[model samples]
Target: MHEFTVTPYAVEGDVDYDRLLEQFGADELTDEQIADFPQPVHHLVRRGIFYAGRDVDRFTAAANCGDTVSIVTGIGPSGPMHLGHAYHFYHAKYLQEQTGAYVYIPLSDDEKRFSKELSFDEIHKHARENVRDLVAVGFDPDRTSIVVDTADADVVYPLAAEFATELTPATVEAVYGPPPNVGLGFYPAVQATHLLLPQLVHGPHPTLVPIAVDQDPHVRVCRDLAAKQRYDVEKPAALLSKFLPQLGGSGGKMSSSDDAPSILLTDDRETVREKVLRHAYSGGRSDVEEHREHGGDPSVDVAYQLLFYFFEADDTELERLAADYRSGDLLSGELKRHAADRIADFLEAHQRRRPDGPISEVVEPYRLTDGERDQLSPEVFDDV
Candidate 1:
């Protein structure tokens, strides 16, 4: 068995995702839960990319009843957004459209500064670009709220301060090793604030946070705080997903911070094609003759996995590809090209929707309203 390490800041070795659920004490998502999702379930959920969850039943139940349900999913603005980040955001958007779920996107620029070597200016620059990509996802501006840690400090910090008192140094140290800086040590509270923002603004309600399995710690930490009953908020629910395979096919999570080549959201069609053909790992035999004789393993093929993950939504098409690859009817190069073409098409549509105006103007519609700000941090707006 390969030893794996899964943490907020690092993922190493080939992860045993099932083992991770046992380690983290989260439940495997049941079929009933998946079926309960608004009709025509998301590929991520229907196909098992989002495989496990914590307190998911409550959120799904609320969504089914047409009750107010919110989803909190975020990014660390350390670099440009990539395909790995897009699926999660897009899934949230789908839920928003299907269920009228309020979406809260929090940009953790401060956390990136504390962890990475990047300057605040550089991180904020990435934040602006990240926001552009997020706005491009076509979320309802009235129902979606985008909060940046530094930019929205008036609301974020006050809530963090209150939650910080409930979080102890020992607990923080245990959950995450000793912090390299005080900023990271205090970040859990800020994270808790982000998780609870919807409830704080609109009163206690079910909130779902869809994140990769590695980010479950943040949800757990926030759940513990919410369990304290000091606040009138419900424990936030979580939907945990497997990492999108990197171009190198190392089985590690694709990340912008890593040295491996990633398909950035801004990459043009030609660049995307080149990256896949040159770097994507193949599960076919070493020689074409041998591959034709023995067939290929679509399960291990990066191209096939990409299509299975998000690009090809039709179940029948995906199954046909798998069968053909296993029966020597599909070549590795052909599969890569197919995946790249689908990806390029998705990116082209996404890029076309991207707003070209100033970041401030683009993000204005999604910012928290004065009433919400005042509700979250009354002290900041007291005299106004």
Candidate 2:
């Protein structure tokens, strides 16, 4: 068996998603399960970008029956928001729209601090910016709650503390390797708190986490905690996806830390084009005559993959572009520019909706309400 790392803190080397299912004990989503998703499933699920999952049927069944269902996904505030981050959130928003599922978006500022060389102040700055981007995603303010781990410690910490008891140091080390400090050792508990948050606040109903495949370890750990029955919570089901390829044409997760440029949510049309044209790897041959003779390979082309993964929503149009590229009628540069234009259009609309007011005012409506906070941590509420 080839060894590759897949942990909450790190993902390296090429990933075999099928093997990941075997290692993680999750099932590949069947067509029937995909169809069960509220009518008109998002292309991500329909096209199998979200390939594997644990107990997806349970979540879909709940959604179909109009039972209380929730989607929990989080972001680490070590860097700016990128297209890869937006992919899952958009899907979450789609699910919320169709089924009225409660959406909990946790800004893991504390986790970022423990894992990265960032000051708390810097992490909070990123968190605030991330909140603005998330707000723009248009989740129903009434049904959505965004919690920053440090800012919402009154609820977050107490819940994490209780779950922390179940996690042994050995388990943490085995999954994440030795932590640099005590804080990192306990971060998994915080993550578990994130996954179980909906049930913890509203009582156990079906909860699902839509995340990239590398992050499945966090879901697994949290599921174990829920299975203990130490708290009145159900294990979070997962919808696992392949990494959106980096612009450098690598078969690995995209990252802010990578040398290849990432297209940030804040990038402008010109900047988007600059990055794609300059950095996007091409599968077309060097010479025009050779490219026309051999055509291009969409399988290894980063530009086409970007369009396939999220940008190009129209299936018929996407197929035309793919077919054209493979026939060498669409030049590599043309494909890159086409993807850049589509992405810039998306970001422009997203930026237009992003709150321009003070962060506190914009985030106020969606913060956990007093009563909900009390449900999670009455003891901490008294001190606050």
Candidate 3:
């Protein structure tokens, strides 16, 4: 395929304070908190923070080893699709197109138990909405597929069951929440099943999952299951993105539920600008004059973090901003101004280039007949 340069980089203020709340056990964070989890283990992998302890070289070589590369990602229509969500998919699209990897997206209706109250039809409606949103982010229908978990014939579920049987609960808890939900207890199994779906369908033998840091637990679960698979599951790899903090807070990260901290991808440019200027966390000089003269603390500024993802430029520009802002030459307004422009540019470009329609073509579950489903070994479903 086409090769896009993948580089090591950081976005300023990409810290997700609310998400961090779960990580640090902090109830609240003042404007001063700026640190994030340890740097992602692999610098070369596109967006490394979200990945577990994977080395990029191994992934790169795997991409090389495969006759065709398959990159897997999933989404549940729990809420609207935001710019933050696009970051992960866009990176995947770039890497997939560059590496000639086929993008396999699971529409993840099966996991919609989160909105279980909704009728199957209603659940599917939102799932469809999520598909349009992803298409808007530039996925090529011909290149990408969307698989609905519920519709898959027995062929996929049996594979999924066998896959789930391999994971242990301790492994799941280690990579995710403290008091794990019973739903989450089985999360790894489902995740591994998703990763391997393509393989069962005559696609790539081993696929990779790309996600953000918060979803690291899923991959952690996969890694653990891979060890036990002697031959049972399709062990997958992943790429993780670091979380970007809210507009102004530092405690945790942008949470789907916290409207105050996020600038939704659907937000208009003017609204985006307003949020960044007024709400984006600031690391500038305490006073307007001091910040302009001394330059801003890029570390503390949410705008910088967002720009790291939106700017599409090298680090030198950020350093320049740092120098100017510290000297009182670059104002918070200037940072917001640039951030707004880049964000606006990104959104518009994405809208203009959004994919034509539903990724259903790419994600259609591997259909199986009743006979095939019945043929599945009962042993595969043994509760782990």
Candidate 4:
């Protein structure tokens, strides 16, 4: 057995996802659950990129019944948004479109400051850029709300303080080690607030959080808080996902914080091509003659994984590519080029939709409405 560590802060070793489910106490997403998703299931869910969840049945039941459903998926704006970030966000958009689910996207600028060396200004700058990328995902503004920690502290802080009292420092230490500062000690509460915000504003409803498996601790903590029943809310369900393969082919999660080259959402065609051809790991034989004789392993090829993960959505086409690669009919360079082109195309579409205006204006449509603010924290607008 390969020894591995999975935490919200770090992931090390070759992760055995099934074992991770055991360790985290989350249920594997069964075929029944997947089928329960709105017809024409998303590639991410259908393909098993999102393979595990907690309390998923409840959310699915509400979604299938046309009851109110909500999705809480967030980004920590410590760096640029990458392809890894797009899969879940796009999946969230799909859920919203299919089920009329409300989507809540929170940018944890303060948490980034607590963990990373980046200053608040730098994190906020990234937060603005991240919001632009998220807006490009084309969520229904009426049903989607984007909240930033510092910018919305008027409501975020008050709610966090309420939940913070219930989240003990010892629990924080057990989940995530001792914080360097007091800010992080209280972040779990804020995260709980993020998970519970929909219920707080819209009243109790089934809320789902689609996140990487490592972030399950956040959901677990929030679930514990919800179990206390101090508030009228159900435990937020979680759909946990496997990490998108990094360019380095180290079998680790792709992250902007890592030194590995990430396919940033802003990269152009030429840049993407260069990065893939140079950095993408290959599973081909050392020489062309040997590769043609023994065939390449598409299962281990980073290029093929990219296509399998999200870039290539057609199952037939993906299977064809994989079979051809296994037969040595598709060369590694050719596969890399194909992945690059597909990725560049995705980024181009996203870039085209990316709003170009002042940050406030770009985010205004997605901000929590005055009525919502009053519901979550009426004191913030009491003077108004």
Cα lDDT of candidate 4 equals: 0.91
RMSD of each: 1.3, 1.8, 9.4, 1.6
**Count of clashes in candidate 4:** 0
Q: Could you give candidate 1's per-residue lDDT for residues 249-319 as a string of tens digits? A: 87788877556688999999999999899988898888888888999998889999999999999999999
Candidate 4 residue spans exceeding 4 A from truth: 380-384
TM-scores, one per candidate:
0.98, 0.97, 0.73, 0.97
Candidate 1 positional error at 356, Å: 0.5
Q: Give the candidate number with the greatest TM-score.
A: 1
Clashes of each: 0, 0, 38, 0
When sorted by TM-score, best at the front, the candidate numbers are 1, 4, 2, 3
RMSD of 1: 1.3
The true-versus-predicted C-alpha distance at residue 173 of model 1, in Å, is 1.6
Off by over 4 Å in 2: 1-3, 380-384
Q: Return whichever of 2 and 3 wins on lDDT.
A: 2
Q: Where is the poorest 10-residue window by lDDT in model 4?
A: 375-384
Best by lDDT: 1
